[model samples]
Target: MTRKLGLAGVFLISLAVMNVFADRSDKEVVKRVNSIEVVALDSVEGYEKKYRIPDENLNDLFAEKIDSLLNSWYIQNVFEMPSGGGMQDSLPVVSIPDSVYIDRLQAIDSYVDLSFNKTVKNFIQLYTQRRRDQVEMMLGLANFYFPIFEEALDKYDMPMELKYMAIIESALNPTARSRANAVGLWQFMYGTGKMLGLEIGTFVDERRDPVKSTDAAARYLRDLYKIYKNWHLVIAAYNCGPGNVNKAIRRSGGARDYWSIYYRLPRETRGYVPAFIAAAYVMNNYKEHNLQVRYPDFPIVTDTIMINSYLHFDQVSAMANIPVEALEALNPQYRMNIIPAKKDKHYALKIPIESVAEFIDNEDAIYAFKRDEFFPNNEIINPKSSNSHHVSNISGKDKVLYTVKSGDNLGYISEWFHVRVSDLRYWNNISRNLIRVGQKLAIYVPQGQADFFASVNRMNFAEKQAYKKKTPVTKTTSASTQTSADGKYVYYTVRRGDNLWSIARKFPGVSNNDIMRWNNIRNANKIQVGQKLKIQSRS
Candidate 1:
């Protein structure tokens, strides 16, 4: 009987150890899932919040948020592949079915695989202390973004798992900026966003709007899939563009495989598809790495209202009893507090579902408040204010129409044209502190102002050319200068706390590459806080 009891005790101890291991494995999986959600969602929120600032502060704030999100997400997501052990060993192996394998093979043949190489692996591993820690940080951020991405993808009948693509492109960071000047979660460039009907101007950038941008991304991906009929090719096209993929296919003698033309693709484009696949794999199986994710503290549901005119976020939040930050998170496309300034324009305003009725009830009051704040100290005229004054002055022969870009404001424009914001407001008859894409304004400048502006632009262009010709191709200075007409050139001296993106926007037609080339900058990570360089004007 003593022997029997001993055997029973041994069994009990074994059972307890198994239970502990099981519990730990479950917890680790949960943690990883939560972390990914947080990273993705927070990135979305960060980008949206940036668009809520005033026009004058938009560019700098946008660039700052983009850089911050990019660095944070990249560090968090890029981790070493885990060795076989721990929870990963216990979990059931995910099998690639024959059909799936066939599909993958077909995709591999069509587009060049740009998987992370030894260099990228070494960089990520050496950069972070523990690979698991990096994974956990990225997973934490995913908690915030997956829901948004899933919803957007679902609406377009795309695979929900495709949401992880943002992790590869922008590390689920909504405000992420790429070396190629791609912006937001989908990493859309200016031209691509415009092609997808995403409006960009001084007042707002729809590409920064989580919902809108996601929708555009979905449509774009769908279109690519339709054209390529292969998921891998679609992803490659997204990274390097369909034009490049077509050229690559031609070069490969019509061999439609990523590996076949991998070496022929552009340096960045080669890694685009591989990074995506690896991200998807890691995100789906983070438990293998012992990563933990922290859940986000917000519900997924939000309310939408159709706004007919300009409205301020502060006013809406006050009326709805919601926090200003929450409102901004919900609607990130608006560059300023005011919506796009077009007559009878319909702006979709998002709010918490509970605040919908309250928002509607106080809508009139909000508009009245905005008008009052805009035209304070002005006596009420006998006649009611015409709607024309509120409408963007895109018409009229004497008017100068300006579409606002990522970094522009009255002050910036005034400085460029030697006018004051007050004068600009008066000349345009703009009220309510609102602006929009395609909105035209009447500038009461002297008759020769255009000519003078053109001449100044020419001089600036010339200065850029001269600088480019003289400077040795150093990475630091090459990245910040641009070529201009004539021998003269214009460049930006990087101020303290300056970033490449901010400097890039200071000049017109100056790309991120131009800045890098002028400054001879190789890796964007090496830029110091106070380095001075040349930049193109944003005029």
Candidate 2:
């Protein structure tokens, strides 16, 4: 059943997100993200104008996802950054001289060059100055992961300082995923992870296993070092791959050193070495720059239990008294919170040291807790297999129109409507990020509350502001699912702890996108108090 909410009249949201061209005459552009509001210069009564300096060279090729990193299961559930006392309030400008940085670099013992240059200086400043809080968080996370890294690097007889590459690769986040599809702390692409003997299967992606990925990364670094004995060239190759590194070397007329082939390297590769050097410097000399080490609250001691049967985190939580979040933090390799341990193959599960004995005592009970529900038909539903990605037999998004309003940029509108900026452009045939006032743009959204999204066209500035308050969004978000006419396909109502990932697992062939379409949501659909998860058969 396609249920549509009976939203009242024609209120509006301006289709134009906001224009970047300041010289053009347009209505005020307002950017709202969650609770934060950003108004364009000269658009608001008390606002003042500002300008930005351009830097085409050495722009962030490896953008840091500090927020996402901090939001990972390991940090959110297992760790806490207790409030830093007002010590941060009364801080003197902390800037070390270039010579001091050079001295510190020379003091450390490592096989890498550890050379100082303008690019290295800039990146060091980025960690020390612009993102101190995030760096502090990384420093704290290092307490747990650094030992594993050191052990792996030592086993390979590689420079221990090379561990800093994880910081640059993922800010030491186990779940970090790049826009280019590289994933985990070591940022391994699917092909690379597969080639390196890291298992990427239905229930597990070993790329996210800190220990496995770290060891694999060390092996990879050693191989690169073998190909090119110079660490700098090895680092460059790690970033852009050996093919690009070879091209850069060839382009530089057979130069063997990193600096000699620097200009010939890809723009991102040029910054990779410098960023790695800066990361190394910051991790070592953070205290000198008035940065405090945030501490990880995760258990310092843990024990591993091998499983020869299929298991779910819920089962562990119920039997071992461990929270699912902690289980996820400990075993990120289990993509579905499931350990698909077979009779011939066993899988390792980590628990706090105290719970190990109890877990071993009740191991049978844990596996049998909700066996039928979890492992339907006593078989693991491999989501990676063929037909796992749902392609709707019916069209998903219904098209609606919104007139481009003043101050609209592609970003603002995309954010407002819960659609991708790229999708918005592709749908409207937009060539660039710019949008003109009063241009009619087609917005494709689920049919349930198309009225709310459609309101963008008719509402005025004040009306849109009032509508944008978003306080009563609960009314919209609580839109429930009604089964299809024949009731053949299964439907799941949202629950408090239920997320798209977790919910999608219940339906073997359903994609998260299909679930989003059915649930009348665009991006994030928080399962509120009134929300329900409908259960039906997939006919």
Candidate 1: minimum summed lDDT over ten consecutive residues — where? 1-10
For 333-432, candidate 1 gives per-residue lDDT tens digits of: 7766557544566878877665677778887887676465443343222112323334223233233445544344565555455444666777777666
Candidate 1 residue spans exceeding 4 A from truth: 1-67, 70-144, 295-299, 341-343, 375-539
Best candidate, TM-score-wise?
A: 2
TM of each candidate vs. truth: 0.47, 0.59
**Candidate 1 lDDT for residue 221:** 82
lDDT of 2 by residue, 1-539 (tens): 01111112212222332223235333434333222223332344422222121112362554456546655555544443222311132233366675677778876676776766557777777778767767877886787689989999999999999999898888888887877888888889888888788899877899999899999999888877777777888888788877777766666556676766677777777888888888888888888887866544344356788899988887888787664655777788999888999999998888767578789899889999868656767887643232332222226766788888887777667645655566777788888677899898887876554755666566554334223212112132224455667876544456544555445434423333345546665333355544655443221
Model 2 residue 496 distance off true place after TM-score fit, in angstroms = 36
Highest-scoring model, lDDT: 2
